[model samples]
Target: MPVAPAASLRSVRTLRGPGPLGAQVPGSGGAYWARLLPLLAALACVTRLPSFRWPLWSPDEGYLAVQARILAHGGELYETVVDRKPPLVPWLYEGSFALFGDSSLLPLKVLAVTAQLLTAVLLASLARRRWGDGAGRTAGVLYLLISIGLNPQDAQAATFEIFMLPCTAAAMWCADRRRWGAAGVAVACALLAKQTGGAVLLPVAWLLWRDGASRRCVARIAAGLCGPVLAAALLTTPSGFVFWTVTGSGAYASFTGSELHVLGRGLVNALVLAGACAGIVPPVVRVLRVARTGAPELWLWLASSAAAVLLGFHFFGHYYLQLMPPLALLGTAALQILPRERTARAIVATGCSCAVFLAWGFLAPRPDLAHAARLAEAVESRTGPKDKVLVWGIHPETYWLADRAPASRYLTAGLLTNYSGGRNGPQVGEKYAVGGTWPVFREELRRHPPTLVIDDSRGKPYGPDRVPSLRRILAEGYRPVLRVEGAVVYARVGRGGEGEGAVRGG
Candidate 1:
C-alpha cells in the first residue's frame, strides 16, 4: 500500500483539536480546556463578523447613531437627544464615533462581541467553580456558540444589554461564591448600564439568603444594589433619576396594552426561549433524578432568579438574552446527572442548532431595507440643508441615511394607521387621520414645510386606503417628483399666477 501523505496526517491532527468536530474526540485534559477557549472565541467572531458591514441599521440603531453624532459634536448627552433609552448605550456609540469617526460598523459590533466573549469567559469560570473543568468548558462553548446563534439585537456594538449582561453574570457568579461585596459592585454596574439590570437584584438577594447568610448580610446586599444608583447620581443627579424613573418606566409602559404587529416576531421569540429551556431542563431533571444534592441550594437560587426576571416584565425577545448564561450553567450542572453520552449529545446539539438560527435571523435581509434606502436617496437628492425631512409611517433608519435633520415627532399618524393601532384621530379625508386628533403635527409641517414628502406605498394605507391623503396633498399644491419601488416623492408646486416664493421646493 502507498504511504499516507504528510498533509493528510496534519489535517487529521488539526481536526482532533477542539474545533467543532473536536467534541467527538475522546480525551480530556488541561490541553483540551486550553485549546477550547480561543477556538470558541474565534468561531464567535467569524459567525457575526459579516454583520459589521451589512449597512442596514435598524431604526433603534440609526436613532442611537444620530444621538451619538450629536454627543460627539459636543451636544448635551441626554437633554438635547430625546431618545427613550438610558444614557449608557448612546454614550457607548458616542465613544465609538470619537474613535472611529464613521469608519464602519465594526467598532460598534466589536464592542458587543467583546462583551459577549467576557460573558462566556465568566460563565465558564462560574461553571468550573461550581462543577469541574469539563462542565465549565462545556458551558463556555455552549455560551459562545449559542449567543452567536441567538443574535440578540444588542449583539450589535451599541447594545446596552451586551454591556450589562457580563456585569450581571459576574454578579451572579460572585453571589454564588458568597463574595457579597464583589457581587454588589457588579450588580450596581449592571444597573448603571441598563434598567433591566435591576431585575437580577432580587435573584441575587435570594441567592445570598439561601447561602446561609444572616439577615444582616441581606441588608448589605441591598445596600450594594443601591451602589449603582449612587454612582449614577455622582455623574448628574437629575439625569440619574431620569435614567431609573422616567426612561425606565416609560419603556416598560409602552409594551403593555399594545398589539404586536408582526405575529412572527413573538413566535420567533417564544421559540428561542423554548429552545434555551430545552437545553436547561433535561439536565436539571436528570440532576434531580440522580439526587446528587451538593449545592442544590445554589441551583435552586439560580433557577428562582431566572424565573423572577422572566416573570417580572413584558420584555421583547432580546430581553431574555441575558438569562441564557446562567441558564446554560444551570443546565450543564444538571447534565452531570446523566451518565448516558447519547442523551447529553442530543441535548447539546439541539440547543446549539436553535442558537445558530436565532443569530442568523438578526443579520438576515429585512424587507424594509430597500424602501428605507430609496426614501433616503430621494430626500437627499432633492432637499437643501435648510430644509427638514419628516418620515411618516416609517422608522428612523431612512432619515439616518438622508443626511438631513429629522423632525422631532415620535410617531406619525401614518405610522399609527399603518402599524399596530388603526387611525384614532381626526380624518384628513378618508386615507389619512391624525393619530390623536393632533393638528399640531400638520401645523408644524406647514410652519416649517419640508421640501419633499416620500410616501412608502407598501408601508401602510395599502391601495385605496392611501388615495385620500395623496389627493389632499396634491390639492394643496405638491407635485409628484419621483416614484421608486414602493416609495413616492412629492415636491411643492406653485399655484397658477403665484410667485416662485409660493413654491416651497424652490
Candidate 2:
C-alpha cells in the first residue's frame, strides 16, 4: 500500500463507463479504482504466484541477491562485492533483504511479481487510453502470457530486466499521453535499474519531438532525466559506476556475431506464432498500418530495443522483456483486426492461444530445483551461522540459498574474468581472483578461508590456459565430504573436528 506519486495516480473516475449523472456521484472515483485495480492486481498476483511458488533460482538471481546482501551488511559496492550491473538493482535487492530478511528468495520474487503487476496495469492503462478497455485488458493478458510463461530459470524472478520493466512500461504510458516530464523520470528510473534500459530514451525523445511537443515541454523531460541521473551520480561513486556500467560492461560482452544468430531464431519463432494468431495478412497489415498511424512510437521502440538487444554475444530471453509492452500493444491491434464476432475468427484466436501456450510449455522448463536445495542444505549443514562460505564458480545462488556470507568480496569468477579490467583495485588481491585468475582465488582462500566451499565444475575452469585455483585449494586444504547435482562440497580439513569428517551421500 505504498502511496502513489503526484505524477502517477490511479484516478478511477477516468475509468468509469458512460452512466447517468456521472459527475453528481459522490466518492465514485475511489470506488471505481478500488474495484477495478484490485481485480487487475488480483489477476496479476494469481497469474504470477505459480512462478514464485515454484522458483527456479537462477545464477543471475543469486548473484544479484548476494551482492545486495553484502551492501545491506554495510559493505561497499565493487570494492566490497562485485557486479557489473548498475546500483539500482542491488539497491532493490537490499530493500528486499532489509524488509523480508536475507534468508529466503521469497522477498525478491514478491518484488518481481509486484513490478510485473505494475507493468501490466500500466500497459492496460495505456492501451485503454489509446483504444478501449477491451484492448487494455488484452494488453495485460499478453504481457502476463509472455512474462509468466517464461517462468524458467532463464530470467528467474527479479533480474535487472524484470525490475526495470515496470519503469519501462510506466514511461511508455506517460509518453503515450504526452506527459513528457513524467515519462522522462520513469525512463531515468529504467536506466538506473539497468544500463541497457537507457537505450529506450532515444526513441522517447524522438517521439516527443516528432509529435510536435513544445521545446519547453521537452526541456521539462530533460530536466526530469537530469534529476535522477545527477542524484545517482551523487549517490554512487562516479568512477565506480562508470567503470562497472561502461568499461566493465564492454569488456564483458563478446564482440562477435553470436548473439545475432540467436536473435534471428527468436524473431522467426515469434513471427510464426504471430502469423498463427491473427493470420499472416492481418499481422503484416497491423505492423505497417500501425506504424503510419498515431502508434508510430512502436517502430521507434522496436528499433531502440533491437539496438539494445544486440549489445553482446550472450542474449537471454529477459533481454527482450523491454519489447513486451509495445509488442503487447501490437498484438492487441492484430487481435482487433480479426472479427471475433465470426466463429471462424473466434476459433482461430482460441486455437492460437492454445498453440502458443503449448509451444511455451516446451520452451519453459518445469521447476526442478532439488539440486540447488540439496547444495544449500549441504553447505548450511557444514557452516556455522557466522561462518562464511565460498561458491567457486557461476553459482552465486548457493550463497543466498545457504544464507551465508561470501568468503571474499567477489561473487563469481565471471564477475572478475569478464567485467573487471584493472589490477590495482581493492578486490584484485593476491588471492581470491588476481588478474581474474586462479592464483587470486587461491590467495583469497588461504588469506580469508571459508569454512565450506561449493565447487561448481560448470564455472569457467582453470586449465592449460588458466591456473587451477580451486583444485589446488581442494588438494591442499579441503576434503570432499559431499557431492551432488554437479557440485562438490569441500569442507576445510583442519577447521572441523572428527565428528565433522563427512556428510551423508558423499
Candidate 3:
C-alpha cells in the first residue's frame, strides 16, 4: 500500500494552524464552499434516494417506531414497551412520530438522511482541521459513499448505529477543538444512541490527557457526560433504564455461538466490510504506518471503533458504520500523499463500488414484505385498533403493520426465549429466560390479556408449545383463528370471535 509521504505529513502539520481544534485552515472561504456544496448536494441525493421509495427499512425500525408510538400515547419506556436498547433512539422516534404522525415513516426517514449528511459534514470539518480543504471534502464524500455501500437492510435503515455516528463524529471534532465539556456532551449523546458509541469516549479522553487538560476541564467533561444520563433516568424509570440498557444488554451480548462459529462469522463480516470499502486499503495502510506520532488520537479512535464493532461476535454490516468516520478521516488524509494518478484511481474504484450499492438499493425489488404484510392484514381484519396483540417470535413488524398495541413490554419473543437472529441455531436457551424475563412476560400477559396471540415462530425455538404459560394461555382462552404463511394467529376465545371457536391446529 502506498503510504502518505513524509512531505505530506509535514504539510498537514503546518496546516493545523495554532490550537489543535480551533485552527483556521487556509482556503476555507468561498472557494471551499464552491467545491463542497455540490458534493454535499450529491450526498443528500445518494443517502436518501433509496428510502424515498421504501419507508420502513428494517425490522429494527418497526421496533423503534412501535416503541415511539407507545411513548407518544402516555406510555413509559421499559415499563410499557421494552427493548434492550438505550432510550435516546426511541425518544428521537417519538419526536418524529409526534411531529409527522406515526402513520407514515417519512419523517423518520428524513431524520436519518439528515443525520447521515450531518455526520459526513462533521467528519469533513474534522478532516479539514487535521489536513486541508481537499482532504476534508474527500473524507466527507468517502463517508457518505461507504456508509450506504452495503445492502439496503443495513445501510438504509434508521438504526441506532446510523443515529449514533453524527454524535460520535461531533465528539471527535469537539475534542480536537479542545472543547472538553461540549465533547463530553456529544459523547453522552453518542452513548445514548448505542452502547458501542461509548468507544469514541476512549479516544476523546486520550486526546484531552495528551493535550494536558486541567482538572477543571476534566470536571466539565465529566459533568457533561453525567447530566444527560441523569435527565434521561429521571424522565424514564431509572431501574428499568438500568435493567434494559445495562443488565439485559450484558446477557444479550453473552448469548453468542461457539468460538468456531463466532470466528467464521467475524471473518465473513470482515471480508464484507473490506470488499465494500476496498478503496480505503492504501489509506488504512498509511495510517497504520504513520499514526504513531502523526495522528495518534485518530489511530486510537479507529482502534476503539474496531473493538466496538467486534462486540457480540455478530458483526452485522451496520456495525461497520461505527468505523467509517475515523477511517474516512485517516484514509482521506493518507490519500493526500499518494500520487495524483493513484489517488484518482482509488477514488474512482470507491465510487464504482458505491454506485453498485446505490443501484442495488434503488433498483432491486423492494424487500419481501408479502408474508409480513399478509400476517399484518390477517391481524388487522380480526383485531380492533385499540386491541393489544402478542407475538411469539421476533416479529415486531406485525405490531407496527397491524397498528395495534402490544400486550407485554417484551416486544419480541427473543427476550423470553433467548433467541438471537444469527448467534444461535434452532436451539433456544429456555433456561436462560429463568432470570425474571419469563415471569415478567407471564405476568404482563395475565394482567393485560392479548386479543390476539400470533405465533410467528414458524417452527423456530419459541413455538407456542415451547413455553408452558403461553401454551396454557392459548388452550384456556385463545383459539387458532387464521394461519398466514406458517404463522398461526390465535384470537382470544371471547373477544374477536367469541362463539366461533375451533379446535387448535396441530
The residue-by-residue lDDT of candidate 1 on 191-268, one tens digit each, is 767666766666577667656668777777767767666755565446635753454333233333333432344466
Q: What is the total number of backbone clashes in candidate 2? A: 9
Model 3 regions lying over 4 Å from their true place: 1-22, 28-31, 255-263, 286-293, 364-368, 496-506
* Model 3 residue 241 distance off true place after TM-score fit, in angstroms: 1.0
Q: Name the regions of candidate 1 deviating beyond 4 angstroms.
A: 1-36, 149-158, 211-224, 230-267, 276-280, 288-315, 340-363, 384-387, 409-484, 488-506
- The TM-score values for the models, in the order shown, are 0.72, 0.77, 0.92
**CA lDDT, every prediction?**
0.58, 0.63, 0.78
> How well is each residue in 1-506 modelled by candidate 3, as lDDT tens digits?
55447765663563333355546687646778777867876786676688777757777888898899889999999787887788999999999888889888888887888898889888888877666787777888888877776667788888899899999999988898888999999999999998889899998998899788799989989999989888887889999888887876554576344556667766776776676688988666754465434466777888999999888766677887788888777777677665557567777877887888788788867434556677788778877898898877776877888898889887877777667545465445566552577778778888888888888888776776777767887889777867776888887776635526653442
What ordering of candidates by lDDT runs from best to worst?
A: 3, 2, 1
- The C-alpha stretches of model 2 lying farther than 4 A from their native spots are 1-39, 213-215, 256-294, 335-368, 419-446, 458-465, 469-482, 496-505
Better candidate by lDDT, 1 or 3: 3
Count of backbone collisions within predicted model 1: 3
- Candidate 2 has its poorest 10 consecutive residues by lDDT at 14-23
Residue pairs that clash (backbone atoms under 3 angstroms), model 3? 21-177
